[model samples]
Target: MQSPPATAPVAAPPERGTSPRRAAPRLVGWLAAAWLGPLLAYALGVAGVLPVVVLGLTAALLRGGRTLLDRLVLAGALLLGAACAAGLLFSAWPWGLHPVPVAGTALTVLLGVAAATGRRPRLPRPVPADLLPVAAALVAAGALAWPYLRAGDLAGRLAYAMTGEDNSRHLATVEGIRAVGGYLFADPSAAARIAPEGMVWYPQGFHLTAALLDGFLRSSTAPAGPASTLDHYLGWSLGAWGLLVLAVTWAANRLAGPRLDLPRAAALTGALTAACLGSELARFVVYGYPGESLGLAATVLLVALACRPVARTGTQLAVVGALCVAVGFAYLMFLPVVAVLVLAWLVRDRRRLRRRPAVLAVVALLTAVLAPLPAVAGLLRTDQVDNVATGGGVFPRYDAFLALAGLVAAGLFAGGLRLPVWRRYAGALAAALAFAGGFLVYFRALGTDPRYYYGKTLHLLLAVLLVGAGAVTLLLPAPGRAAQSRPRAARPHDRAAESRPRAARPHDRAAESRPRAARLRWRTPRPARALAAAAVVLACAGLAGLPRGTGIFAQPFDGRTMTWAAAWWSGTQARPGPAELAVRALAQAPAEAGVVTVVVSDRRREGYLATLFVATLQGTHGASGPAVYRLPLSEPARSAALVERVPGRIRFVAADPAAAGIVEALLAAHPDLAGRVTLQRLR
Candidate 1:
């Protein structure tokens, strides 16, 4: 029999430390670093030092003698520390501030420890080729799972776009780019008119993309009224979304390598994608919610770049770090998270720190380069401060307790593997308590309807659980080395080697025969198990309640009335005709003629038709100097009185061609102004 391929050599354990294993100091220090770090950073504006303190403590506990695992941990820590320092510097530096004193102090201690123990370590091996296929499968699974996971949010976004109410602002942005040749920043006046008055709260990156598309589309088309192209908008939105997914998948694959098997990778990617698509972050990309996604993506990429091998030069590292910090300025949530994650890395990877001083320097340079623009913008704009403060109303103070508890639970569960089963159970119980406490605190603090908060909490919890489950599943034990090398079937000699007594031979035979029966029993139960699963799924579906009607599934193109109107407009190559002409004629009329009254069938002055009329008049003749009044012909006497108020000016009555006959009847009843009024079709 062949021996199992020699198991990859496990790294030798580090030598035992002489110091007593006292839990109190270590636990207290960890809690302080985790809880107090952010507060200190916020207050002092020096965020990089806390992580160094944490790293020093961790190193002291772990460093009796170096092992390969210790070295790897040290490398990871250095990378993290460097990222934190870089982010803080970049975030604050543009204001002409330096975080260098804090960073320098941290670094001096780290280097001193490294110099005393003086040992250089090599980088880990490149990702294995065999793992590529597993990564591809994982990414594919995530993409496939995305739509199902995000059905509700996707449906809502589509509905919002189809309504053509607030959507017009999105359309106008696209149109303005085509017509005026610049984004909103370039032509503030034009943009201000087209965009909703308070839309600055929305993220600018997605809208900026829309503007770019408009410019591209406009080069081919003539000057038009509004951008009504649905296909174009959908294509651009989805394309950007697809790119985000691809980028995240690539990053995950790079970070985790073959250790992240297909199923685990898929679960992680799917959860992340679902979170992005369904959370407030998606609102940033979809409804132009504003800078959150840009900041998040930037922060993640910066960490990834910082974690890259040290063969790269300081200039290259600085460029990557700068971009990260620049993008982070777009949203504030990323800053603290980025800081914590990086600090965590630094504590975990000390040895790498000594070898790559240049990494720290590059991070500092990048942070210096990228942090100022937003800080300056924030200082100049009081409204920005008000908006940020208003958003804080949703953040409940108690949620911090919950978050802290959850973090502690996760850490304990991960590190407590060597404990007894009851201890493991206790760790799990602690985690659950933390989660519950956090969830309830957040729920009450947000002050929204409980149902809505519950939904949000459910989604957040699901994402957390999915990631946790995936990580655990991926790390579960595989076959032991000896078992892996064994033959599929037992030989007679193997049975003889057991040296069983003759009397026990029959029992052995009976046990051997039982294996077949067990196999058969397993096969027999599968169908029942499947049926039970199907029944449970059906019951859950029934409890959830299905949405009623074709309306739920309806797409934008399903609105036949709107489709017909669009088709007619496109088919006619229609220029605005009589209504527009009448507006121009009225504007050109002498001041004594008074305001022109253009009577249309609708009561609402800002319906789709009314908006079109207003846009056309503006496009053709600039807002007609004489106010054009819209009087609804549905009320004939009132319409007549309004027309009489503007007697000498052209009294143009326009109605949908289909509604003209009804209008004519009303006109026939009113003889006094009938001769003066001109009826026109608005087909």
Candidate 2:
């Protein structure tokens, strides 16, 4: 974390509003990456989520010295990118080829190669600063997550969900991974049940991580049974939402520059929070799209990295290329957006990048090596893409307003162009323009309801706009200083100032005046200037509200969203339902009991969702009932008769009290299930 040695000794302190040499405040980066990295590795290891930790460490070995957030982001991208590529590579293997061993072997080779490069990973230990901004961002994100976390237990936490269809299909996809031992596509029989079209080329980035997390939970947690299955999906879904907010806040802070004061921290936190709450993207969680949520977070993080200066080294570019590949894995649709940012990064550093053609070639090579090529090619063939592209609907209600607001925000970025530090912000500016331009093109060329899929891009654009809001705090002088200090007359453009790096530019008192075109002279009151800056920050936050959705504020309101969780929770209701009975009975099973499949015989429709829950919990991969149908059959004796034929896989029969006795009697005479088959009766 040592700052590069000062080129020349300077008497004056660094300029207040200028960009920093490093992406983040030194102390904050140290706490985020250096201290947290080992703890994360240890936690993942104990939880049996080993592949992610191994892959992350491998990427870390390649290079380090970026800001704390930047380093962690690169590591995360590599972990996900490796899993994704490995999943696709071995995706066609037989059912017995488990994801763990396959992923472990692949990562081992990569780890060895990274080690052979002899580049030790070393994080920079930048100078210390208060962690106020980081702390504020965390607190704000926790508040946004109140709906999921407010519930006392896993079942209770899952009650806040809005859609069961997407949840079930996604959980089925996760279970599909566990069932086949690799990607779901390798076993179409298992994969076909998860999605209508069969998940042959569906992005597994979100599902890969979820499957790993579910494995950890399955290994560690006591048998809460079916409820635990729901817990895994719900937990990851909520986490994806929280991650989005935190990523945006981090980007905002990074863009605001290194030295953070109290006001700047507060501004960054407020602006990001308000912007997220007001945007349509906040609804991704309730809408049951955690994959898209996680994808967007990766998308934002990728852009943030592009905004920073990258050294012209093969290893660094390779790391960046892996990040691009990770974005595709997280969500394919956002890859185009990330591609634009990557191009901007190269364009901004064209001088250095052009000098080493081999480095650019290395980046392309690494990206291809890590990409899910077959899946990328499959994007065009999927009916889902066709529906999104050619589907019906007009432009979004707020499209025009958002477009104007985005342009207004671009003006803030425009002001940075005058400074030599503009290179650092060029990517963000390009992203905002990309979003606006993409929106227009989609509306004209694609489906009528372009908003259905393309609307999510607005969230990324909004994040960039809000970063501009946070940077305002860094640009304005403190009220205290403004009040006491008088601005000196405008001095001629100094050759010395032009020669120095943006961060090293000394705060010269004699030359402390606005540019020659100044309307506001140095004689203008400093307190008023400070107040004006604060107003601008507030104004930016308010502007975010211009594109507000109907449920903009409802997302964070506990009282309003808590009601949505009731249907998913099985405990303490006036009348215990079929799903409740099945989950409760499953919960009674011993933790040591090896995977047990139960045929659900609830006459009610609740059995459909309960079947998915049971399928996930039993590790049967959607093959749980005596006969797999959309809903469980009501006749227990008939199901028992079918179970008698397949005693090897069907371990238990969950039936209502009225039919449990008949089923139990039918199974009693069977030699294979004489004592093995247990009837879980729901009265």
Candidate 3:
């Protein structure tokens, strides 16, 4: 095994001014590598290949060499780009119906064509040191997931630890897509109450991929019954978190590179991973925001890509655009945050922008044209905008603390100004701050609570700020430089040194001749620099300790947790509930039963539970529009009338003691209703 160098070597830059004929081969190589990695991995029964492929292909496209960290950062842009592109295309006929199979065949064909016409992609060789960050990320993921995994029973393990109500809605939407074999627009009826009338568009990237995985898993496992909604939700949400942690650690290491040795790289990765896992952002999972989780992962990757210079090739740029599209589909709100980063990137790389004036003009025009697109067609309906706009603060007390922290981070970022690389950190910090400021001002202008929606940006801001502060490690002298600065006594075996140039360069002589006091301007005092490095290390340690200190880590364990709110529905092992049994029987219901309607007596309390499971288990289990309709069963006649009005041959009615008698009486009153209805009595 070869020892890794002080700085990981990178691939040779793509040749400048290459002819189209030559570029074509590399472009093909890029696509083939990108597509084939995920496609093959999925075929091989690998779970979580989406992020891995995005990360790998990004490395291949950016022509990021053997340095592991570079690919992680660049992966952000590629993940969104590639997923969006593929997802949109998958929404097309035939492909949407059989996404996994179609994706495999299409990617295989593309790979074959590229192999026949283009040069093989010269992928970076992984080093032993590369595994360090990956291991750290895995540890962080495992730690975060410990609460759910700690359950003694299978049902408990599959239960989503987070209490967020959004999980039920999201799962229902995913179930709708899976049932329809395409985007919700393809068959709005399948979406049940999840898709309200006139809500024209919803980003389906996250749901689409989850649905595909659901299909893939069902086909592969040959399960005796319908797959668990809780299982799918848990896997997807936690998987996104894992990818985010991996990206954070990799980007943090890359941002503090050149002087970082193998041990330092490992330490930095571990510390950053811990801080990221401990940060307030981890609560997103607690809130059951799976779409936001995936989108945020892509957002971090995009930021990392922007922290560096622009992509070298148009193919790489196209890949980035695809990622943007994917991000929009995954979570529309994050796109504005992405746009802020792109603007900062453009400003930072003005020279590149200047050279490509046409590209710059096109970007500006697109920005102007596309900025208002969300308002026109986003998930938030016109009526809902005020509800969102008028929302109260998420955490009012933390405002002053966060603001102070931001200023301190900005000050620390400024401390690294001597190095040209500091500009990268500056660009990232500026983008984050600009995003925060812009959102805060907008909310204030609307005269609403500032922190409600604005709170979403906290994780992104904290991640960037910590990474920027971590760059303070650069203030410490490089190992080789430190060695050179030390006074060395001449030795008899120093022949190799004398063979080298003995003449001191003018700048070197001037530096040596300067008084120590005068040299203070150019050179930081060693003790002061060491102290600064120590302080940064302590600050990061403090951040990593937050979850434990604040007891945030124990939240999932302590909270009113559920698996799509089905834990209460499923009941304990000693007392299994009717959900699974009911779904099984419903699957075998006669055609005369027609389209099934699930009526849960308590719609406001447990309606979503019925909706989510019915959609997952039976596929498109809603009555006409909503998955399950709630009626005031307390009024027997009115409730019976409403149930009779449900346009379906078969109805699965779940009602408690109070409502069961009414349902039974309704059945008795109408022999036709008794034939059509299957009532499950709740305890």
What TM-scores do the predictions have?
Answer: 0.42, 0.65, 0.70
What digit string (tens of lDDT, one per residue) describes model 3 on residues 7-46?
Answer: 2232343334557788778667766655666556556776
lDDT of candidates 1 onward, in order: 0.37, 0.52, 0.52
lDDT of 2 by residue, 524-561 (tens): 46465446547655665455442232222222233333
User: Per model, how many backbone clashes are there?
Assistant: 14, 7, 5
Point out the higher-scoring one by TM-score: 2 or 3.
3
lDDT of 1 by residue, 1-683 (tens): 44222111121233233233563464446445554554455356445344445444434432211222222333333333344333333323332112233333344545444333342222222223224323433443343233323434322223333322333344444444334433333344554433433332332344443443333333232344222343355445444444344334434432332233333344445434433332332333333222333344444444433333222233234444544454444444334434443454445445545567877765756565545444444456436544432321232223423443364345335532322221323332334335445655654685643332233233223222222322232233321232223332211111221244544321222223444444233222435544544454343223212111111111132343211122222222122333343333324322222323353544433222333333322231112212233444344444455555555544344555533554576578776656666555543
Report the alpha-carbon TM-score of model 3 versus the true structure.
0.70
lDDT of candidate 1 at residue 626, scale 0 to 100: 25
lDDT score, candidate 2, position 269: 64
In model 1, what is the error at residue 98, expressed in angstroms? Answer: 37
User: Candidate 1: which stretches are off by over 4 Å?
Assistant: 1-203, 209-230, 247-258, 263-295, 299-323, 329-333, 342-363, 388-469, 478-683
RMSD of each: 18.5, 10.0, 8.7
- In angstroms, the error of model 1 at 439 is 13
